[model samples]
Target: MRADIVVGLQWGDEGKGKVVDYLASLYNAVVRFNGGPNAGHTVIANNTSFTFHHIPSGALRGTKLFIAPGMLVNPEILNEEILSLKQLVSSFYLKIDSRTSLITPADVVLDKKIEELKGASSIGTTLRGIGPAYSSKALRISPRVVDVLNESFDFSIYKKLYNVEFESELWLKNAKKTLKDYASDVREELLEILSKQGNVLFESAQGTLLDPIYGTYPYVTSSNTTASYAFVSSGIPYKYSGKVIGVLKAYSTRVGKGPMPTEMSEDLAMVIREGGKEYGATTGRARRIGWLDIPALKYATEINGTDEIFITKLDVLSGIKELKVAVSYNIDGKEVENFSPLENIESAKAVYQNLDPIPKLYASDISYIIKNGWRAAPVQMRKYVSFIEESLRTKISYASLGAERGMTVKVE
Candidate 1:
């Protein structure tokens, strides 16, 4: 396997960066496959905190990092992130895929305008213009990075985009700058990094649940954030069968807007938050917390084709007295065994139960769960994790005992 995929399994803040950084040592190149500069990922290592957006989480590891074409490139944010990364260490290197399109500031303005029309209720967008940028690219209106390198690339098209296109018009209206003025080909530079690096880790932004076509509707970002996206964005063919690791938290969380059937009350939410710094790295917003939702995870596991699963934030529940897991949901008074969203499923009644914590607290092996809490899992927390393994037929290989790197256990 040449392509290893890494993705978040929860709403957005499931601590994928920590695992990516920890396991990056096993890979050669790390690629940021999808999503734009909207999400924030934090990596904690050597007692320092590193926050990254456009760049893959692996960038913090001082490894070869590629910003793939799947991402909506915002030059300002990308440039700022590169500079910030450079300041973290002396030898940090980052590359931008020339095929990736740049998101002009005009995109942001248009995005805000459209959302404004939605009135009193909005999807809590970052207003970074990611959605608009993707829409433009799909609609063939956005100025792609490859276009800049084309000698035949129409300068008039650029003019039309800025002076005429919605994003361009909005940019000209909002910012002192526009997208047309900043298009460039960083391909040659990015290819050089690929030549020097052999092990590439494709890092996906957002969870599969947030994928445009697959994720929760209207609340999803404008791209596919699965391992498949990594292959498409990096221009790497269906060649290598590398290990794809899906990073999930022991529980669930989401910020902004969406249906969270298993959402916990403010008290239980705060309990988990204090342990893992539940605030988003990108928005600095407190994420909505919930019990581990099996129906949701089983779907994510399948979409990502996750070969191995890594469970994070396991230690956060030490204070919960008891752990609750949501096994299934009751939608419209009917048993919805599958994870598919029910139409008019404004809310789902979570079928939950609690489980006792492992007395060992932190064990290097997952056997401890079987020894102490295995039986308790069914009656208490619902067999969410077990159901995930059975449903996806993939075993979880790692369990995060704590937030720090040393706390992860490689489960066989």
Candidate 2:
């Protein structure tokens, strides 16, 4: 089998890791295609919880895990994540694509410096320097693994250049640390994995809307988080053309700052927060909660060339007075449909259309959006699934009724 992609359809924190973990067992390898330590994916099983940052959710698969070249490697956090995976799960092999870029101490320093200077106006960065790293890459001034690979390369020259350019860019103004020795070859390892024709699974860290190019400007994450990132990072052409799986939350939630058209009130937020545990995996921050924005979901599905969609967390919306799905937006007081990379500024903001919520609560502790108890859990669960099928025009292939792997339902 070829590459199968899994990404969050919402802004972020869309339970992509859990779904990836569940599907990992089916694939021979799971590859993390993009992002740095800024993403956190939580997977719960047997009353034990394991969260991962900068590691593929498929690392839980105990297969060959390859960190593709598209990723920005942070050794410190990668080490912790690997150790955590070892403790949480049984066995897995992780290899980095030598072509992958490195996120040095300078990057983090740069990130914090930007936030420190920008203060409140900062675009809710994780201080991981992802945006700056990507920007440097675009400007053709990035530091790559190849740079560190050349034994005879002038590191002194590299340092002077990086320092001068980095300073000129104002990325790491207050930088106190400097990288001494960086020697890691992800190319050799990736080639070895590829030679085996081993099944490669590409895992994406951020959601679709968070991509720097497509997401809200200055607020989006670095790099294109879409499934295509896997192709670019893995050096495998058409890897995802036939095997992409877009992961969508039954409802939507975004963490930190940004314009969220469907954001809920604090009280309503409490309901979803309690029901869904919508918190960031890396930052431990509370996520912005809202109902499914069909237009937004459709945009991601189309752009990613998503072959299929996986709607998760159906158990949480068992019963509420009424539920809302953002069918389209009212931009500039005009009704329009379709998910374009919005630049209308005022018009780009989403306008949501409301759908009635079901009054029966299927999961009381999971979210407050549902008021009805899950008395007839199975039958009620089916009803919720049908609603999604019609709204998103995608099947509810997976349903997470409870937290454990076994508690999930398979609709297909």
Candidate that scores best on lDDT: 1
Minimum summed lDDT over a 10-residue window in model 2 is located at 171-180
Candidate 2 vs. true structure, TM-score:
0.83
What is candidate 2's lDDT per residue for 176-219, written digit by digit as tens? 11112223354455445556765566788889888888776667
Clashes of 1: 14
Minimal lDDT window, size 10, model 1: 171-180
The clash count for each model shown is 14, 23
Query: What is the lDDT for 64 in model 2?
Result: 64
Q: Candidate 1: where is the Cα deviation over 4 Å?
A: 146-197, 358-392
Provide the TM-score for each candidate, comma-separated. 0.83, 0.83
CA lDDT, every model vs. true structure: 0.70, 0.67
lDDT of 1 by residue, 1-412 (tens): 3567888766767778888888887776777778888878788777877788877777656676667777887766766776677777887556565567767766787778878988766777778888888887887767565554453233356445545344443432322232333333333444454466555677788888787777788787788877787766766666664777988888888888878888888987897788668887877788888888888887887777778888787666654666777877888888775676535445678887666653324343334554454343322223444554665578877766666666666654
